[model samples]
Target: MKKILIIGIVASGKTTFAKRLSQKFSLPWYELDSIVHHNTATGRYKRSAEEQFEIIKEIDIKGAWIFEGTDRDSYQCLYQMADTIIFLDTPLWKRKVRILTRFIKQKLGIEKCHYKPDIMMLKMMYKWTRDFEQSRNSFDAKLNRYNEKVIRLRDSNNLDVTKGTRLS
Candidate 1:
């Protein structure tokens, strides 16, 4: 429960769950995407795999943290480092709706995003979600190694932050 890794596809509620869990435990949270794509004084740039690993290691030294993002080969080590892993298995229909809603919000300037909220990005989100489903068997196999520490959630709201437990 100390070091948590929340992994999910786009619009799977990883960020929301991480925020709630972090607040409940008074622990710092991080977006893995931010680590991969470093934002600097000049602009955002994708960091080298080695640089990303260094940043992750620096954060790991802090003892406890919540890192959330879609799975990436660059940070596969997170699975070994995390004390717990949360896989937000939100329904495909819900996630699809969320993707559209999120895009609308971002385009309307009601929501913030690190990347551009354009048609291409929206298309990519859907593509990623489909790809995730196609590759879920492999992902599940990878997670099987850490089954004891992994919690699968179909709905983020079903988690009881106060008790750090799942309600259903």
Candidate 2:
């Protein structure tokens, strides 16, 4: 409830959920991508793992926070510190639709992203969305070892961050 970590595949609505949760709970929110993918004059580039860990450590020391991202490896420390973990188990079809829509939005300059949108990025996103099942299996395995309360949200429509309720 205090320190929350949200993990899921690309376009799984992690950012949206985190924003809603942050507003509802009045907790600070951080997006891991913004930390890892530092915007530069040449575009976005990932920070070194050591640097990323250092930044994450700073965030982990905070009293309360809600973080969203898929960097379980670099942010393992934060994962350990979080009190609740939310895994968005959204359907692949829905995720695909979201990916396409978001890509279009970014291309049209209507939506801003941590990284610039390009053909290669779009292709990578599609591949990532397609391979989500495997990634989720790995994520679940890692989470199985953690004792924190984990919430798996399968349907976006069922999620109510304000009330922390899930409708069937």
Candidate 3:
């Protein structure tokens, strides 16, 4: 209802869905990648974990906003700041399709990372999604402590999120 944080694997639609949520709530949309990639180039500039967290703290200090991304402890730097936390846990194959599509799109010049997203970057994201251990991702820890406020979406098609609640 207030601050919302989105966590998801690569190509899980976090950015797109976050935009929708922003419109639905009439709140400003904050794409972590966008800010993290700002002033750099497409897909090339990535902020360090420390800098990322700093931004989150800055956002929280400024008050209510919708944040969308994974792997930022800065958002968690101010835990209890978010009213709802969304976890987009799509299937590995679905993610791979998305990743490849993004790659193709970027490579085709339809869109750029604002920097660069080479094969290695894609591989890392793919690996993270395919083999990401829930226990390993910081989101898992935040989730465990805030399960009541968490919404888990297991499918890429969003079969589990409904009526403003998590179905499963």
TM-scores for every candidate against the unseen true structure:
0.94, 0.87, 0.77
- What TM-score, to 2 decimals, does candidate 3 have? 0.77
Candidate 1: pairs in clash: none
Candidate 3 lDDT for residue 32: 79
Off by over 4 Å in 1: 161-168
In model 2, the clashing pairs are none
Error of 1 at 89 (Å): 0.4
Best candidate (score: lDDT): 1
Candidate 1 lDDT, 26-50, residue by residue in tens: 9999999999998889989999999
Where model 2 places Cα greater than 4 Å from the true spot, the runs are: 41-43, 157-168
Task: Assess candidate 2 and give its TM-score to the true structure.
Answer: 0.87
Q: With candidate 2 superimposed using the best TM-score fit, by how many Å does residue 63's alpha carbon deviate from the native?
A: 1.0
Please state the error at residue 159 of candidate 3 in Å.
Answer: 11
